[model samples]
Target: MSDHKQNPLSREMKTHAMILGSFVAIFWVTELLDMSIFRGRLDRFGIIPHSLVGLRGILFAPFLHGNLAHLIGNTIPFVVLGWLVMLQETSDFWIVTFLTMIIGGFGVWFFGAPGSVHIGASILIFGYLGFLLLRGYFQRNFASICLSVIVGVLYGGLVFGVLPGRPGISWQGHLFGFLGGVVAAKLITNEKRFYS
Candidate 1:
């Protein structure tokens, strides 16, 4: 057998990553523009978890990070997971991503304390990971199952993202993002077979 992983790449997955990259790039650039042009009004809109006026922050907050470091921190995983999720031949790729954002953001926005507006790629990444991993069970593909186990074991540090973090970082975002991922997985997964 080939030692290399079966390339998970496929038409649907390629499109998914492209589309996600498109959005992330656009958003990142737009936010940078906002910072440069608007004297940083764009970041003022970040999800601040203030509860009273912080709700809209959740919708667009992930787009704004403290600095290049912050932006890059979220971007890499976003791309990786986005790419992985897009690779899914299943039709729910985009749906799961969009829904994950909604569920993940809203969950934090609503349930999270007003002072804790979370934003990051962990939820989306975990969702993507969970869905892609579990999809094997639904599709009855032994290969996907193996991939899922590997992903879980390899990316185990994902669990650490949920904790309080260095200044200007939202561990809350990681938490919400993870929760969103779980919900998305359940929604997109097929029930017919555990290995589908």
Candidate 2:
């Protein structure tokens, strides 16, 4: 009956939640190891603009952070927005995340100042924010439109992060990460859900 139908959906939700939680857990664990065993040296793996050696950082940067404060600041939004993206379709999370890292990381690598390293999950965060905010406009679905409005109202101030002027901050990552999200939104459209 109704209970049988709900059970499968509930189990799927749990699986999606676990996947999202595991990703955040990896961030925390990476930070802990970097702080204790690596003694902050792990940050060198972060994206360094225009250098061949720095190119490897494009794969590593999002997992690295400058300090506890930086990591903490990024964790909440990463979890919340990340969860929101998964709610529509769990696979979108992987697609959006991969796109953000590649597109956003390349932006930092190409434009980031010499001798500077850019790191942190904020790039993915801004990318998620961008995807969530714009997905509705592209899909023209009522639920997505409503979700976009809520995301905007709750996280609107993040728009300022895209602008240049924050010393030591990679506005390039923010700008391009957001663009990456828009690209994700354009590329992936949600399949119709039974519940919706």
Q: What is the clash count for each candidate, in the order shown?
A: 18, 0
Q: How high is the CA lDDT of each candidate model?
A: 0.64, 0.89
The worst-scoring run of ten residues by lDDT in candidate 1 lies at: 2-11
Worst ten in a row by lDDT for model 2: 187-196
Tens digit of lDDT per residue, candidate 1, span 78-166? 77666656554445666767766776677666656666545445557766765655656655567667766776776656777667767
Q: lDDT (0-100) at residue 179 of candidate 1?
A: 63
Q: Where does model 1 exceed 4 Å of error?
A: 1-14, 50-52, 115-123, 133-140, 165-167, 191-196
Which tens-of-lDDT digit does each residue in 25-136 have in candidate 2? 8888999999999999999999999989998987899888888899899999998999888877788999999999999999998888989989999999999999999999
Each prediction's Cα RMSD?
Answer: 5.7, 3.1
